[model samples]
Target: MCKNIQLLNDDFLQDPYRDYAHVREECPVYWHEATAYWWLTRYDDVHFALRQPQFKSARLHALFDGIAPERLSRFTPLTRLLESRLLLTDGANHQRLRSLISTAFAPRHMDLIRPVIRQVIEDLLGEMQGRTSVEFIREFADPLPSRVITRILGLPAEHYEQFKSWTNDIYQFMGVSPVDRTTRAEIASTAAVEIERYLDRQLDDCAVGGGPNLLSVLKSASEAGERLSRTEIIANVVGLLNAGHETTTNLLGNGMYLLLTHAEQAQLLSHDRSLWPSFVEEVLRYESPVQIIARQLSEATEMHGVPLPAGANVLLFLGAANRDPRLFWQANQFDIQRQGARHLAFGFGPHFCIGAALARMITVEAFACLSKVWRSPRLAVTPRWRSYPVFRGLVDLQLHVTWQ
Candidate 1:
């Protein structure tokens, strides 16, 4: 094994697949010297790690462990909020939170939300008329999901920008390195407190003026006569807003980038409308939105002959596993027609993303609209990717398109 494998530099950030391929081949269960986290790259290792009981999901505390004492006090609200989030829970707690939240995301509920998503796509496209070159992330991708999520939560349209800003702050903290996390943690803490207060007020209103919004649905969610606590509702509502939009935004940008760069794949959609769903899956696998998910070992375990002790922090590379050549025939290629693309982009086991269906629906609708209107789409400039370690997305995708 090479000494000091530092994978967080600029080149790796811009394109990490080559590095992933190297690690998967050289050391599938390699430990990072700088970050002190075990990195898993191969498909089987990552898949097994995700499903094994030894690999626990409640690992967010490890992120805050390195902060200074005085500064850490400022993160109490953020810490509480993170711990309460459905993303970080396990076992019975995870089951309970998921059951309640799943009600709002049920198939019937998603059917009701579909028309709203389509309408939002239309409105966003309408605003982009008469422009030859457009920034996809800002003009369309970001707003489509953001608007839909805000509407789903029953928040006012004017608060959309605030919602986006706050979510970005929280995500920034999520994607930052532990050493540099103090500043991001402060920002995220403030965002957490502010959003908690905002949602608390919204929940109060939802209590009195009940509607078809998620707040109302969550407030009413019960299992075995136990309802979600106010803090639980707020924490998960914030999580939904973040997960609801961030990944979808990346999916659209990455999908469009692939289509624009590869004319053949883009043409497949023109011929077969049935390929839209598969297109979403291909984008997800080829360039996963959420690249890395962290976990802590609850007990001693061995992965690919590498001994991992209890409490070890491990980073599962979802993006890398999706492209693992062992599972995928032409893993790196973007083909919408690939069959049985068993990619773990949304993850596996009990902690799988709750908003997966909603994300797929939103991406399908947005891409369908883009395919119809953005004829002969071509990149206006080279695509620039965001520097977030956890999420993979374009900073901006400027494209030249002909309105059909």
Candidate 2:
């Protein structure tokens, strides 16, 4: 094993799969500094940790250590708000609420909205007209995710700016300095309150048989003796919006970045579009939008032959898992045509991203629109990625595109 390795360096930050390769080869599950969380690197370890019911999510108020109790207490209401959602809830609450809400995301229902999603992507791409080159991140990725998520909540297009602002606040993690975190947390709470109120109003309207949006879907869920509370409904609404927006945005951005870098792969897929699905899967495996998720030991659990005592906090490194060489030889190689593309990008087991299908469809269509509109795009600025233990993504990257 290499001595005194640090996972939070420039090399790891720029292309973490390299670090994943090292750790998976040497120490599959080694403790790490920086965050001081037990880190899992090998593919099997991460997949097993996520599947094990002994590990639980709705974690410490502060993802970082040494947070004050008083400050942590302030996060309780918000944590409760977070925990009410499907990802945070476990066992029965998770199964029940998810079983009901899962209907909203039924494959047939998602297919119903494909045309709308396609239209939204084309419209967003159309807005990039007149320019031979544009920053694909701003022109394409950002607007595409924001608009699609807004449509999903059935929020009016006029209110999308509010949703955009709210998403920005929620997506903040280790990228911000210590001093800025408090203010960002405050903004997140306030935004959560406002958005929930908007959802509450919509739910109330749907209760009066108003319309058949997601709100109405939740209303029907409640009336069908599912016993969902107002808080639960609010939690689901905010959680979906927060979950869908930036992660999908970054997926679009990073996927584009990857394709733009690998010219031959891009041209190959451009010619035969049926490879789009596997191509997106490989992108998720390669440059995953969600880099990490935290879990606490609900009970004593041994992972990768290392025991995590009950109540011990651990960080599951999704980025590392995607690059585990044991899982895939030449794991660092970004090959769209490769077989067996299972990645931890959407996580695993009970907490797997419920909107994975929707997010996948959105990304596929967004890239499809881009493929139609632009022949090639060169990056203007190297991407500036946010290095948070909780989120893995680029905050911004400029692109210059050439249309045919």
Candidate 3:
């Protein structure tokens, strides 16, 4: 049953949906021996697992033992920071941190940044004016959210390039294979240490002279007058800086790819302005920015009649769940008009991405601007896909643009 479910298969990497279809139909809750993680593909199973407390997010500790046990000391900085992130915490700790930081993403704050988002998009398009062929990821998709994130965090926009380098180092370790992880972890640890020290200074400055930024927002945030510690604040900020732009970058690149490939569907948005929201939703569902997320079972549990042992890791295939025919009609087809069950692209339950609203707004503004400015955009060459199983995005996309 699991013969066709090869996670590292070349054909599977190119188009995972085909393999996902096979697994979802044949073995919705199958074990992947190579990775030693239970694969959950059905929408209900994935959704249920995400909400249950037993399926804990705090699983990074296993990375140390599983990857390179002797290299534990080397990954100290990286592991320490990662383990503190709200994304990896649960229960009261996760709630407290999520609530405090969520103030920065409140609708009011996002509303204030709407014009800024549009301006960034316009400026990026402006830069594309002379070029007939534009590398969409590097020239536009990557920088848009980087600029936005820096603005939201009140950091100097000039530091974005450096920030990207640091975050990519960390991301590489998180996504790379075990064979390469030890080296990646060392690089990631160095990057983490540097970023932490940088954030420490920023936090000090914020404490002394408060500003209208995420740091300030977090500083003042309190739950029942209980506040975030200095370490907790810095750790979550690291998460923000990394997650804030990374997913948005994927959304833009992925959405653009879909739009370029599906000409008729792409044109539908221009004719009917109302389709913008659904367009974004469909983009998220069709080619989710975050393809897979993991949760370790805190204790033994049963899922879909399968008994999972304690401490078992389950890989929730959000991409597969989004395309599950059980919930969505003609699930594999890309149709903005079709809407029934909501997509788990941002995930479901407590760990649902808090920056989702900001991501959606950025995507809407971006495509809206591109529609008006690019005139007619089409793929210049076959886009290169990032091979990581956890995140779905293009490495680079070249677009043949008729600049308006």
Candidate 4:
């Protein structure tokens, strides 16, 4: 319980960068008694924790065992499903899962899907023809990724709205610290079961030689003697659907927020389409969609001269690391042209985002379309951010855009 360190408060929520900067400068690795976890704020420390083998990601099982013992039985199906997800595992299992899933999300696959993504973007923007103002999150940011992922998963187009709702409920459990763990877990488990059943049905159909969707790819890999199990397939499909939808949705929303606030950078990018790639990277670095990631220490270790015992939960603040002055010059500034803007927005090492390519492709095309079709897009009202500690995304971005 460090008196000087405080998160989970309004100030931190409103401007987390300021709090993160202070922590990086004052105490790089401080223990928060309130949350019962160690905070890693500096760039080097967070980076090391992410890549270090000793900091394991497979502790969620143990973590939940301690948090809600009464609800454990009810959550077993969901827990087992999550444990089978590639993101929650490490080492050999993680590698195997990643390799199998990578086939469906390969760079070449993303390239092949680029035209489809562009068409979706064009159709979305086209729908805004007679609009003076639009709720960007609903109209464009949120729906784009949801629709794209649903299409990729070979789900019915009519189910896109339901898919988005399910993913949102799951994210509410996954991303935020819930006040009532019992209730949240119950709701999330319900969603997880529904998703699993749907995916399970899809897998059954794909097993009988269905279309060439992501589920079919995973099914083929499994039948071809891969170590992937049916449970793992269902869990990872749920993972892919959630990851594919939520993060990209946030990226588009946050990127537009950054560009709108930094008028000069927006103007620069609007005039020069070539900078969209770098601009996308800058948006990732500036206001990373996924902010905090947690890791458990596998062995007793010393970081910044502070001894930490094995099994200690460490929260690596990726958002803080991205803005660490040691890593980026003028870290707080949003300069798209800034060279060497390497960041951990998608994380690092073995656990880097599997859909990074797809997310970037979606974002790049999003900005390209906006640059071409929208003129002087500005915030129509003050934007509201979602109150999730781990995810930094806007609830809605109302904007006034003139048709070009």
Clashes of each: 0, 0, 0, 0
Candidates 3 and 4 compared: the better one by lDDT is: 3
Across 115-173, the per-residue lDDT of candidate 2 in tens digits comes to 77888887976787768657766777777766776676566678788767765565553
**How many angstroms is residue 266 displaced in model 2 relative to the true structure, after the best TM-score fit?**
1.6
Clashes by residue pair, model 3: none
Go through the candidates in order and give each one's C-alpha lDDT.
Answer: 0.84, 0.74, 0.83, 0.82
Tens-digit per-residue lDDT, 236-289, candidate 4 = 877887777878989999999998899899878767889999999999999889
Query: Order the candidates by lDDT, highest first — what do you get?
Result: 1, 3, 4, 2
RMSD of each: 2.1, 2.8, 2.1, 2.2
> Per-residue CA lDDT of candidate 3, range 11-99, in tens?
77779998898888888789888888899999999999988999999877866556656668777888878887988899998988888
lDDT assessment of candidate 2: 0.74
Q: Roughly what TM-score does model 2 have, to 2 decimal places?
A: 0.90
Tell me the spans in candidate 3 whose CA falls farther than 4 Å from its real position.
Answer: 67-71, 207-212, 222-226
Candidate closer to the true structure by TM-score (higher is better), 2 or 3: 3
List candidate 1 stretches off by more than 4 Å.
2-5, 207-212, 222-224
Give one digit per residue, the lDDT tens place, for model 1 in 203-257: 7777524334888788777323656787888888888887778789999899889
Instruction: Tell how far residue 340 is off in model 4, in angstroms.
Output: 2.2
Candidate 1, residue 57: the lDDT equals: 88
